[model samples]
Target: MIKSVAHAMIYVLNQDEALDFYKNKLGFEVGDDMKVEGGFRWLTVYPKTQSQLQLVLAEPKEGPLFTKDSAEKIRSLIEEGAFGAGVFETENCQKTYEELVAKGVEFIQPPTEQLYGVEAMGIDNSGNWFSLVQREK
Candidate 1:
């Protein structure tokens, strides 16, 4: 049986831009950024407070995982904002939203009171949307 998740993949168009967005805008820390065989870059980022699960910033190219056609389709879908990254927990949704907005993060929804708590929807530089939530205690 699996104990827990160690990494999650987030497909991106450009690794450098994704790195800047996740690191600077969201304040995530870099876990691993290294070049492997076949010139593939293995980059991962995680929240500052939590480093257990790293988000792999992977660029979809014609490689082992996908064909040229599939890679193109995935890239197109990513640019169309059809994919969601994941929900990010925050202590204060409103405050985090304000900070992110000031840092050039695009938000489709402002912090609103949800059934569980406050929630806001934001889009990363790569057009992946994610929810910022503050759960009720």
Candidate 2:
């Protein structure tokens, strides 16, 4: 049987930029920052609350997981705004959105109430969209 999701991988143009965005802008703590085989960087981050689940930030390049052509295609798709990298659950959507905006994060939409919850959409430094959601209490 399939288990719960462990982590999510997001392709980034530059690891340094991604690190700054995730760490400084969004307040995600750095989980891993090291180099593995084939000169590839293995970097990960996790939210302050969900420290168990990490988000992998990988650079699309020639590697065992992806060929050069495929990496290019993925980069193109990301640049075209075709990817929703992940959703981040927060205790308060509006407060978190305001804090992120003060740190220069660009938001696609402000917090809006829906049947499910209140959600705010924002784009990461790599152009991947993420939803900041707060479930109704």
Candidate 3:
């Protein structure tokens, strides 16, 4: 049987910039930062609440998972906003949105009530769209 998702990978143009954006602005804590085989660096971060799940911030250049051309193509697609990263559930959408905005995070939409819940849309540094949602009681 299939298990729960362990992590999600996001290709970043610059690892350092992505690390800073995710850590400082978005409040994710660094999970791993180490060099592995073939001169590749493995970097990952996790949300403060979901510490068990890691988000890999991978550079798409030549390596095991991607070729140089493929990396460029993926980066281009991400820049064009063709990626949707799905929603992350939060305890309070309004509070989280406000806190993120205060930290200079750009949001595409403010907290609004929807059929599913109270949600807000935002983009990461690399242009992947994500929604922050809070279920109504």
Candidate 4:
């Protein structure tokens, strides 16, 4: 049975930059970073409190995940900021947004009240946008 999520992926232009962004900007901790067989680097990170799941910092190139053409297409999309990494929950959307902004994270939208929560939209270093939300209590 599928009990929980293991890894979520976000294709990046550079792994080192992504590591710095996620680790330094987003305050995520390194989960695993090692060279696996077939010349792939298995790099993953997780939120400080959420160690059960990892966010895979993928470089979608001509490898196990994509062909050359497909990789190029994905790279183009990422460069264009045409992808999203889904919602990330936070305890305080406004506070978190300010912290992230101070750390050089770019936000397309500042935190605002929504029916379900307070939300802000931000872009990762790879151009993937994600929603930061603090749900209504």
The best candidate by lDDT is 1
Q: Worst lDDT window (10 residues) for model 2?
A: 2-11
Ten residues in sequence with the least summed lDDT for candidate 1: 35-44
Off by over 4 Å in 1: none
**Native-to-model Cα distance after best TM-score fit, residue 12 in candidate 3, in Å:** 1.9
Residue 133, model 4: Cα distance from true site in angstroms: 0.4
Can you write out model 2's per-residue Cα lDDT over 65-125, one digit (the tens) per residue? 7899998998898888787868888889999899999999999999999887999999998
Instruction: Report the lDDT tens digits of candidate 1 across residue range 44-97.
Output: 999999999999999999877789999999999999999888999999999999
TM-score to true structure, per model = 0.97, 0.93, 0.90, 0.95
> Clashes per prediction?
0, 0, 0, 0
List residue ranges in candidate 3 displaced over 4 A. none
Q: Which of the two candidates, 1 or 3, achieves a greater lDDT against the reference?
A: 1
> For candidate 3, what is the TM-score?
0.90
Clashing pairs in 4: none
Best by TM-score: 1
Residue 37, candidate 2: alpha-carbon lDDT: 83
Q: RMSD for each model, in Å, please?
A: 0.7, 1.3, 1.5, 1.1
- Ranking of models by TM-score: 1, 4, 2, 3
